[model samples]
Target: MTVDPRAALDRLIASLEAHYNAVAGRQSEDDPAVDDAYDILADAFEVYDEALGTAHGEALPFYLAEEDDDEDDEDDEWGPEGDDSYGDGADVEDLAGEARSS
Candidate 1:
């Protein structure tokens, strides 16, 4: 079946936005969760761009390139490594402790 890459990309983009909204409800844009979301979005676009580069008018499934697989496995799960929110274990509490010591 012939699939339109552009349509697929649009749908992916919409899904990402929805997921971001759900995960970041009531959080400031500067929140680390938001930053992680942007990084995820950027990574998604990079994958799409690479796929487009190799696609010859054919429907290519979007996937991360093996070469780009450099993130720690723990980081692959997304959302604070376990929590539903983002931070990478570097939340405001951690920052506050650092600031107090300095």
Candidate 2:
């Protein structure tokens, strides 16, 4: 079956938003699922940005820098070893594939 990129992007956004909302207004960190969803959404955004030249704006980089900081904080408590939640060197394509399979 063919997957529409736009539809996939929309799904990613919805999932990410839902995860965010589910954990809003709390002192605890975001769920690991939210982080995973964010990564996937970022990947989807990157693909769109590349194909449509939509990521060249200064805002994108600033947003990414902020996200990097958030991710760094998340990394401090994500796994049993306090390391990467998605394992070392796991690319977006692999996560995308897992999402598609599910």
Candidate 3:
């Protein structure tokens, strides 16, 4: 299967976040491993963010709301290409057409 970089990044971030949360319960504030995870997460996140910047000429969101993810296909809503919607975008043409038809 072809790997969608953005989707892969999303999954990785989620996994890392969960790992951090779990380790948080088991580790004290002074633990070096806890600090290491933060460093690793930051480095991994930088790769994802850099890929987003290089691939799309924009900063992809680090996280999205659960409700928004379910509202439409992530591929449809945030496809890596031909999806021009970023900040301040709402597909006015589509919206207007839908409104008129309704």
All candidates: TM-score: 0.37, 0.34, 0.43
* Models sorted by TM-score, best on top: 3, 1, 2
Worst 10 residues of 3 by lDDT: 63-72
Off by over 4 Å in 2: 1-12, 15-30, 54-63, 66-102
For candidate 1, give the lDDT of residue 16: 91
Cα RMSD of predicted structure 3: 14.4
Q: Write the per-residue lDDT of candidate 3 for residues 50-92, one digit (tens) a residue.
A: 6666776767656433444444555555433446553236565
Off by over 4 Å in 3: 1-4, 7-11, 60-102
Q: Evaluated with TM-score, which candidate comes out highest?
A: 3
| Candidate 2 residue pairs in clash (backbone atoms < 3 Å) | none
Instruction: State each model's CA lDDT, in order.
Output: 0.60, 0.55, 0.63
| Model 2 lDDT, residue 22, Cα | 51
Instruction: Pick the winner on lDDT between candidates 1 and 2.
Output: 1
TM-score of 1: 0.37
Window of ten residues with lowest summed lDDT in model 2: 54-63
Better of 1 and 3 by TM-score: 3
